[model samples]
Target: MSSLLRIVRFTRSLAPLYTAIIIASVLTSVAALAVPFLIGHATDTVAGALAGETPTGTAVRAVVLIAAAVLLAEIANTVISNVGGWFGDVMSNRMRTILSVRYYDKLLHLPQRWFDSEITGTIVARLNRSITEVTNFMKMMSNSFASMLITTLAVLTISAWYAWPLTVLLLIVFPVYVWLTSLTSVKWQKLEAQKNEQVDIASGRFAEVVGQIRVVKSFVRERGELEDFSRRFRSTDATTRAQSSHWHRMDVIRRAFLNLVFFAIYVIIFVRTVQGAFTLGEMVLLIQLMTMAKAPVESMSWVIDSAQRAIAGSRDYFRVMETPVDPRTAAMMAARPEGSRDGEADGAAGSAAALVRSVPGAPVVAFRGVDFAYEDGEDVLRGIDFELARGEKIALVSESGGGKSTIVNLLLGLYEPSAGSIEVAGHPSAEVPLDQLRSRIGVVFQDASLFSGTIAENIAYGRPEASEQEIVEAARRANADAFIRRFAGGYEQVIGERGLKLSGGQRQRIAVARAMLKDAPVLVLDEATSALDTKAEIQVQKGLDELMAGRTSLIIAHRLSTIAEVDRIITLRDGVIDEIGSPAQLAASGGIYAQLLDLQSSGDTRRLARYDITA
Candidate 1:
């Protein structure tokens, strides 16, 4: 009931359309009732004329009037039906648009944790199915129920005027129908909920298989995947059958009981007519009224069915919208630190020296005693503290699970620290609005994810409003301009999904170009060149150097060669900084950095020896 009310409240703007629909439907239904009465009157007058009890001219006029009324009723029904249909379609589409926008907006604000835990397929299926059901429910309520209710009432009122006994019996039967509907509705809702869950499971499986087709092919698991999907489909089909059977049984029972009562009413009216208490025309009127009453009673089942599905879908949809949003996305926009230039912390061209010159010794980013843990998981970071001075280049080198990426996640405001705090440009990271903070930082990840679009479009993703000249300059700076121009369509060449049409190094350079276009004050490269061959790495490394030149940069790399020239190196172990110094200082100190360097050199030597033997 609450969900239904919520849907109504959401569509309050459509109240005028609803009013128009109901008014047209009521008029149409009222006009239709007059047809039966018109026929009854014509019958009695024609019978009297045939029996010589009435004038033939008067009977002809009555027949003509009845025909005209029937014609007018049919025309009115058509026009009103059209009007009501138009209102319903417009209302359904409008509600769909409103709900779709709200669903996406809520997703943007919802906690990242929810995204991590939920299945993409299931979420999308629920979103689409629920909106459809909700729209259908609203349409039926306006177009069908309005007419049904009005017809039922108008018929009953006319019956009462003719004979009170028949009307009273009908009024008594109406409550039984209502009571039966109420009794079955709860069970119907429960069945629908279960059916929907089965659909969600099947949807999730289909999405998973399609998205990972390559992996399945590589593993030769196509047969297994098909079997799994078939099993889920069978389960969904079974649930659907159960739901349908329950609905059919309830409908059958409701119809049988109503028909029995209607037969009893018919018998009473027939006997009354036979005893001369009612005329043949009056008997016909009673029968017509009974038929009209029966229609709405039967229609009650359909209305409730749509209502149940809608209510169930709405409950799930509302759950998502009502979930708590990520705190970072919810943060209000904050002012730039006092005395900082408008583009000082926002431009990639702003060199570290310029930043230090403006505010000496102040860090562009700082983390103080930060600690973090995943839900029900071990601590990933503990009492970790670090700072990147304005205009300085730093590298974080660590084994897997050393909390390097965790720090980046915290700095980006993707997650909150369990304890302590992080500051960016003298403002708390948690306090700065997420979009504003991210706009000031550029990141190039190892995987280099891309959508299916032209090279220019992908490059301009970070700053969609970037001018052509700006795009060209950024591409040139990232060393991607030359290769992009070689394509048949130049920058307009369509890249396949995730830029899979391009080589790994080409994709990486495109990602770098995107970051270059963003031109943020801070840059983070997470193993950006680690996945490339030697030749590719050399090419991508140059682009990285150009991108990092003027910004305060943080490089996360397992390859020691990549971090050799950074201003400082921070080595992490077991969720805390194990060493921090310049590369030369750490090497001379014979610390973790020096040992790792020697180990890599030894491994390279063995690789060369093996290559010589193969040659």
Candidate 2:
């Protein structure tokens, strides 16, 4: 219920439009109600004429006037109802836009850890289902609720005026029917929630399977995937059957009570009219009013069903919206100047510069006693410490699961260390605004991670404001300009998803160009060229070398030969720094780096396997 109220409050911004819809609905209801009174008057006129107590000419005129009035009322009702519906459509779409934008914005501010535990498909599915249900429910209520309430109230009032006893009988139907429906509310909602979970899981898996169709086909798991999908939906189907049976059984009881109440009212009305206790026209008017009142009662089940769905949907929506955003990121976002492009806040830059000036000769990047562990897990990195001077290049070499990537992730503020602290550009990483901090560093991952867009768009992604000449220059430096120009569209050519249309080298070069365009003071290469063949690696490495010039570079390399040119090598063993020294110094030091080099030179696959390194 609270969730439903919160959804209603979201409409406060469009109150004027919503108010107009309600006003139009009320007017349409009034017009529709006029028909019953006009019909009753015409019936009395005809009755008087039949009794020969009134002139036929007068009766004919009265009937004609009443019939004309009824026609005009109906026309007005139709026009007003249509206008109100238009407003409802506009408001509902606007509501959807509002909700979608806010949801996306919240997602942006959420921490990476929040996303780490969630599936891409499930996240997207929740947004679609929740928003659709909420908007549809709002639109339906806007179009019909006001009119229903008005008609119900008008019918009851007019009935009471004609005969108090019949109105009392009709009133009894509402509470009794509502009470019966209430009996199923808790259990019905429980079943509905269970069903929604199964449906969400099925929908989430469907999206995942489609997105990874290539993998599924390669593994020949089509039958298995289909069976799993079918099994999930079968769970939903069983739950739905239970939910329906419960609702209809209760509905039967409610409907039976309503029929009995109406039966008594009808019998009394007919008997009184035959006994001359009521006029013929009064009896007709009373019966029509009673029917009008019954219409809302009959549709109550549908209204409640829709309302419950909306409530459940809204509960899911608010669950995400209400999750606390990462406070550090939130503060950074709030501090950013409005209308500024990403990471271009002049004030933030000035503050960062001031901190640098105050701490002269600070390391470009540093880690001090850093320790980290994932949620409820043992430390992946422990008592780690290192520093990168300005314009220095350092390589990190380690076996698998040695926390090499975790170090980079912490530097990027993706995760906070469980113990100790890190500093970047002379300021504590936590103290620096995220945009400003990230703006100073550029990263190219093992995967190119390119989106489907023009080659120019991918190159200019980090700096969207880069000029055409600048983009071309960056691409040339990355050795991507040649292949890009080979395409008929040149730089304007669109790359397929994740740059699948291009070779490994081509995609990596585009990523390099993007990093080049960013031109930050610091760069990170996370095994950027390891996926390519010898010739491709050589071609991509040239661009990487150019990008690394005159900047602080942190390299994570699995191949021993690739780090020969690095000024220093840091080797990790079991989450602690095993050796740190110049590449030549470590080669002769007979440490992990030296041992790995020996193993590589000897081509001893078994020994290399012990170190978790591939030759």
Candidate 3:
């Protein structure tokens, strides 16, 4: 969509404020023009007195009136500008809020692959620029452009009253100014685009270095990283200088022609005054009016440049808004009943709450003849068929890239199978509303992704309306209550970003508590304790047991011992199920599971069963 249209639509949302700003803008413009006219009248009165045609008293009264008019005009302009500035600030704040919410919603629904390919800092840079553009565009429309338009019209009309020929001459000059600016602005716009690209690159570089500071330090690569950053900085600096240099050259050309036009108007006025075609008062008035018109004319270049930047930034904003969200999630959103909060399914977290309350019992999860692949890639999972009966627990074991996590992702609807189908609670997974589907399942990942908030807040993430009592109970069940209480603030203790202030075990316990609070019918634990030490692992395992108990559980583990107690184990090879049996049964069969166990156990099944082994 066009940037102006987007800005106008945003303004319409807060019409009363913009309306007041518009009224103020017009008044300010009129008052601004009136000052010049008062000055011209004062000059004419003094000239008449000097020529002995007007009395000194009359000139003094004119000077007093001019002073009063100047004071009033300046006061009106100040008050109106203050009001317009307030409106601009309010509009800017609202636009930022609305755009941020939309961007967040888009991020939530975007495919994981998009994130894999895009840098977080680049997205942040785009959002920042886009929001600034939107706000500035509103300010321009309400104040700067409005004032210029009104003053231009008033100046031309008053000029015509003095001399129609001069008005005609101005009309001819104005379009040429606009046309030349438009032509020159195209190059500046291209430079602006390049400058924006450099900003994205520089932002990405900074984000990467900061995000991986530990890695850089550990590898003693600080110098190399700094050198890379220097390169990016230099490139960005060069682009900025190039853009500034081009703009300077264009400004000189524009100002030269504008000044020449102003001089030509002065010569015409002086000649007309000498020819007796215009009086001294008319000459003074025309000159002042022409001066008023000069400002708007000269400002045309600024208007074009700002508009172009806003247009470019708005296009970036819309690109995210227009990106396609996952179809299942979209369907759930569309199916929201009337009065649904934010048009989200159920309400804020209502889907999960309702799902758990309605059915506390386990829900069956099934995958039949499922074949999957990444976009433009070969199959990662083929002819996969499995079912976790209600309240049953199953383990998945395979090589690093052996479609183990792919299975979990497919069941969670993070990816669609190339062929076949998935079912939950006896309904086609694709047909089930995403809200209902997700709310019925809970998961813990290899890395516990935690937000920056209080401990209680993180625990209640899945169910925001969960009470303090419920949150405490869930934490206790997950073995997180002890550490939480150890902190000075207890439940209110702030956890830093991604729970970095907490250890691996602490973070995992919090994640388990979150899942428990959700009370989902099915549980999937993906390498939940893989990163912890023995002592931490034991603690986290207790929490896992509480979460998985009585739920249809799907467990994927790199450490075979972690899943030793599961009712059944499924082994995958080359994207297909190779074997399915109990751990003891697999050991007896002497297959892939047995081989993995031997690799870890030094050839004794008894010792291997107790020893941690890669699967």
Candidate 4:
């Protein structure tokens, strides 16, 4: 009931249209009611003529007038009902639009951590199912409920005037039928929820499998995947069958009681007419009114079923909406600039770019005694301290799972530190608005992470309003222009999903061009060349060198040779800083960095495996 009320409240903005529909529905009910009365009057007039209790001419005229009145009433009912349906259709679609847009907007604002545990397909499935059921139920109610209520009330009142006993019996059946239906609601909803879970899991896995089809094919797991998907759906099928059986068994019992009560009603009306308590026409009118009342009572099961589904759907929808958004992410969204790029403020002077220029001598990035952990997990980094001055370049050298990427994630505000603080551009990182902080930094990941779009679109993603010439210039500096222009569509070529249509080198270079277009003061190359062949790495590294020029750069690399040009190298062991020095100094210091360099230099594959380091 609360969910139903919430849905009602959510659509309060469309009240005027709803009010119009209700008014039309009432008028339609009134017109329909007139038909039975007119037909009954005509029957009496004909009977009077046959009994010779009135002139035949008088009876004929009265019958003709009654017939015309019935025709007019039927026409009015049809027209008014259609108008109400039109209003309902408009309101329902508007409700759907409002719901879908808000859901999508909420998704955009949810934090990364909230998304980490969710499946992409499950989230999409929930949105689709919830919105579809809610809107469809609303449309059904808007079109039918008003008319049903008015018809039921008019029938009951008229029947009571004719015979109070019959009215009492009809009223008794309603509560009994409703009580029986309510008995199944809890159990039915439980099964429905179970079914929904299985379906969501199946859908999530289906999307995952399709998205990583190459991996599945290489693994030869197609049969296993199909069996798993079928198993989930079969579970849903079993739950659905049980739910359906329970509901129908209850329905059959309810209908039997209804049949007995209706039988009693008909018998009473007939006996009363025979005893001269009602005229032939009055009997007909009473019987028709009973039928009208019975229609709504019989439909109660369908109404309740739809309502339950809608309630369940609405509950799911609200669950997502009610989840707490990260306070920092909320602030970031609230502070987003209108009609400007994502991290830019209102104008050039107040933008993050300007902030970078204002703090020329301060450390561009700093981490002081920072501690970090995943949710409910041991710390990945502890008491880490680091700083990068403007135009300085540093590289993080560490074995796999040694917290290099985690540091980059924390620096970008994807996650907060468990303790201590980080500072950017002379201000505590927590004090800096996310948009302003992120606008000052650019990052290139090893995977490239390009979407399915034209090459130009991907390049200009950071700054969508960048001109063609600016995009081309960024591409040229990233060493991607020559190969891009050779393609049939040049920069306009469509890159398949994640840029799979391009070679590894081409994709990496395009990612480099994208970062170049962002033109941030601080650059982060997170193993940008680690996934490429030697030739590809050489080509991509040239672009990386160009991107890092005159910028405060933080590079993470597994291969020790890549850091030879960096001003300093910070090495990690067991989630804490183990060494910090220039490459030559670290080499001579015989620390973790020096040991890894020696292992690589000696080509000792066995020794490298212990550190999870790969060449």
Which has the greatest lDDT? 4
Pairing residues by index, what is the TM-score of model 2? 0.93
- Count backbone clashes in candidate 3: 0
Q: What is residue 403's positional error in candidate 4, in angstroms?
A: 0.9
TM-score of every model versus the real structure? 0.90, 0.93, 0.91, 0.91
lDDT digits (tens) for residues 1-615 of candidate 2:
677677767556768778989999899999988888888888888999999978999999999999999999999999999999999999898788777766776677677788888777888888998989889988999899899899988888887887788879878888888788888889988998898887788888998898788899999999999999899889888889999999999999989999999999999889999999878888887788788889889988888888888888888887887776544554444543322222112121232222233258999999999999988799999999999999999998888789888999999888888898999977888776666678888999888999998999999999999999999999999999999999988999988877878999999999999999999999999889878888888889999989999989999976677678888999998899999999899999999889888998999878776554557
lDDT for position 228 in model 3: 78
Ranking by TM-score: 2, 4, 3, 1
Ten contiguous residues minimizing lDDT sum, candidate 2 = 339-348
**Residue-level lDDT tens digits of model 3 in 1-615:** 266676556435566767777787898888888887787777878888999989999889888988898899999999988888788777667666656665666677676667767888888888888778876876776667777888888888888887777788789779988877777566766777777777777787778878777788999999987887677667767767877787778778878888887888899999999999877777877887888788788777777777888887877877776676666665455443322222112122323222313323424877889999988799999999987888888988877678888998888888888999998887778777577788889999988999999999999999999999999999999999999999999999999888888999999999999999999989999888888888888899999998988887999866767667888899988899999999899988888788877777675544433322443
Residue 43 CA error for candidate 3 (Å)?
2.2
What's the TM for model 1? 0.90
Cα lDDT computed for each candidate against the true fold: 0.80, 0.85, 0.79, 0.86
Q: How accurate is candidate 2 locally (lDDT)?
A: 0.85
lDDT accuracy of residue 52 in candidate 3: 94
For every model shown, the clashing-pair count is 2, 0, 0, 0
> What is the overall TM-score of model 4 with all chains considered together?
0.91
Ranking by lDDT: 4, 2, 1, 3
